[model samples]
Target: MLDFTSIVMTIAPELWLALAGLVGVLLGAVFGDRFNSFSFKFGALSLFGAAALAAIHLSGGESFGGLVRTNTFVNFAKVISFVLAGVALFMSESFLKRHETIRYEYALLTIFASLGMGIILSAADLMTLYMGIETLSLSSYVMAAFHRDSARSSEAGLKYFVLGALASGMLLYGASLVYGFSGTTSFAGIAASDMSNGTLFGMVLMIVGMAFKISAAPMHVWTPDVYEGAPTSVVAFFASAPKMASTVMFANVLFVVFGAAYDQWQLIIAIIAGLSMIIGALGALVQTNIKRLLGYSSIANVGYGLVAVAAGQEAGAAALLTFITIYAVTSLGLFAGVLAMRRRGGMVESISELGGLARTKPVLAVMLSVLIFSIAGLPPFGGFFGKYEVLRAGLDAGLMPLAILVVIASVISLGYYLRLIKIMWFDEPTERFENTDAPVMGTVVLSAVVAGIVFMVFISELGTGGWATYAASGLLR
Candidate 1:
């Protein structure tokens, strides 16, 4: 017999977010133009409520016969996704309004995306994982092209949809192969089945599918184009929340279901990691567009997280979680700063446009510099510790060569990051960026910056706080 209470509790966060999305859509339909102001508040509140509910269930357990599970690890990732989504939505309103593209549907899609991420983080079976990925991808496709009038926006949507379809097909084919061989789609069932070559092939396909979602290399070709074409506010959410959920999902599949077959997948993941770091680092060096540069930077960051995943131990999982948390916070902060880069003409995308920003908008310049420094893995910033954690995990796992690659990637990444900083501080003034009166964007950026600084100062305490350890142990145990 099924436990009704357990099922309800287990799915409460997803239900709440789904309900919030429905309400947002209904508000848009009912009030028409009057819904814009309320939509931001509604979306933020809904995501916060869902995050709170997930946090309350942190001591999680299996429900729906283990199709879904809630535990500290799952809840932690979900809360981060929800909170980041909410912040993105809240910060996006002014930018969207200024672009004349504000709509309640934006909030609705964001809510739905958060719901999808929540589903992915809590999913305990292959079928459930597929459902979550589809939900997230479908919503993301629409969100990416929210500006229907712009050809670039349309291109982004079409590219994402086509690529996303290919990924989904691959995922489904791999799932079918696993089910055919094991006669089940559950993680436990697959784990207990014989590790045949076909089963291993299926797992590889699944990993490749997921790699596309996380923007890992070889599969990351779509990322720069999409990031460059999409609206910056939407890209902010894209760079942070979805990546978090996908990375956690990838970690879960590898560490939980495929634990016994680590030898088969480890080399593949290592290659992906090394390639992502190299491609992301080297590619970003020549990019003039800020968004494209950050997009490549994101690919590199994903590589760093994957290094931890390839460690295949509890420490690796913990380090992965920690690195992603830092990455999300810093990335959001960077994008928030990007959203603030406006002028009488329109929003700026070129790195040259930021030249001499220090003379006009000293505060924004400083914040951007801090974020860039952190991303470059500079000391006394959260990003440095984030890289250290992953490198430490890689070295501990005896993956010395991988650790060295990470260092090389970091050094290569510094070139572009410092260039951005130099443009802001040392170069001649190109144009005056208009001052943004967007309080929500300011608040989000400030919070992320402060958190990044604090996390750096308390790195040891935060990493050892048992959150990652507990979450990792639950999945790996």
Candidate 2:
């Protein structure tokens, strides 16, 4: 049996988060509106605290009697989860206030979701992974519908739940198949299994299940609708950190658990990745809703991230890590830019609404232009570097055909991104493009813009150091 003390030490950061969440929920229940200001600040601080703990505890490994594992990859995933969770909290504060519900419970749910993500990242066994994912998914469904007054919000939550449940069922069945064949759910056990009867079927089922969760193609039908319907802040939450967790989990299952059967699954993953990219790029082209456009774009991004998994090599793993790190920051920047588009009226949701935005909000227009170019994989931008890493890894794996398809898909993606830029700069303004000022929101928007550019420019040189490398290394294990 593993030492109980060892498991506690290993998962201390998660423990802290759980406790903080519970405390916040209780305090919020008792204090009500009087607690709004305090709860918001405290929740943000607590998430920040979790991040600090994750950073400080990056050294220890192996916990929870072999059921839970800690390593560089999981640790890094934890760090990313905490960091993104912190950002979501900050963004949500303003969002909740605007919606007339700044309850501490909302922040607590997010914190709990972060805790769940950390659990999933560190889970060594399939059971633990399942629990973690469900915890996170359930909390997310609730957050999606938190603004229950809006029918769109309720519909988004319901759709996510139904689809998410189906995905979870597929994953669970796949896990059962593997367990029935190998008599164990541990990654080590799966890797060591000599039996081969259901391994391939199990792998395919498992990949399909994971693909659904990550919103990869063929199973990505629910993504755009849900994203468009959900609150913009919640959409941003779904876009960034969870993808990191799912990507890491996919690598762990495919590379660690099924390493012996790499040849069998690599081709399958490559095909999925390739199809995701093509579908994502093409589907996004016709989308007028900006969030829906981003939804399709995220599918394409996942496609690129999955290429590293398909490679099944250390360099590919490292590249995946770096790619996702850059991806999260850029996505956050993009979402923040979208949120900043509101003028004297409601949010500008349509792509055509951006016509001649450069004429008035020149600063925002410039930032949005940079973000769009970055997403399109233009040079000197983080998205460009991130995509490059994934492509390089695919080439190294000798998946030349798949790499070419990725390039073609990226080229197609340029249509929508460039279209947005053109409308922003060159097209005539609609009657809707009136003047307004939201100082705090504008500052937040500018911050994301500055962050995206800084990371993109420096990732090549500075990405090799500190938590980034440690973060990359964490994924390999």
How do the predictions measure up, each by TM-score? 0.98, 0.94
Span of 10 residues, lowest total lDDT, candidate 1: 443-452
- For model 2, how does the per-residue alpha-carbon lDDT over 273-380 read when each residue is reduced to its tens digit? 988999999999999999999999999988998898887856577778878877776677677667767745677788888887888788778777777777788887
In lDDT terms, how accurate is model 1? 0.87
Q: lDDT values of the candidates?
A: 0.87, 0.79
Q: How would you encode candidate 1's per-residue C-alpha lDDT over 198-250 as one tens digit per residue? A: 88889989998999999999999999999999998899999988989899889
How many residue pairs of model 1 clash at the backbone?
1
Q: What stretches of model 1 exceed 4 Å from their correct place?
A: 440-444
Backbone clashes, each candidate = 1, 3
**Error at 428, model 2, angstroms:** 2.6
Q: Please list the Cα RMSD from the true structure of every candidate, rounded to 1 decimal place.
A: 1.3, 2.3
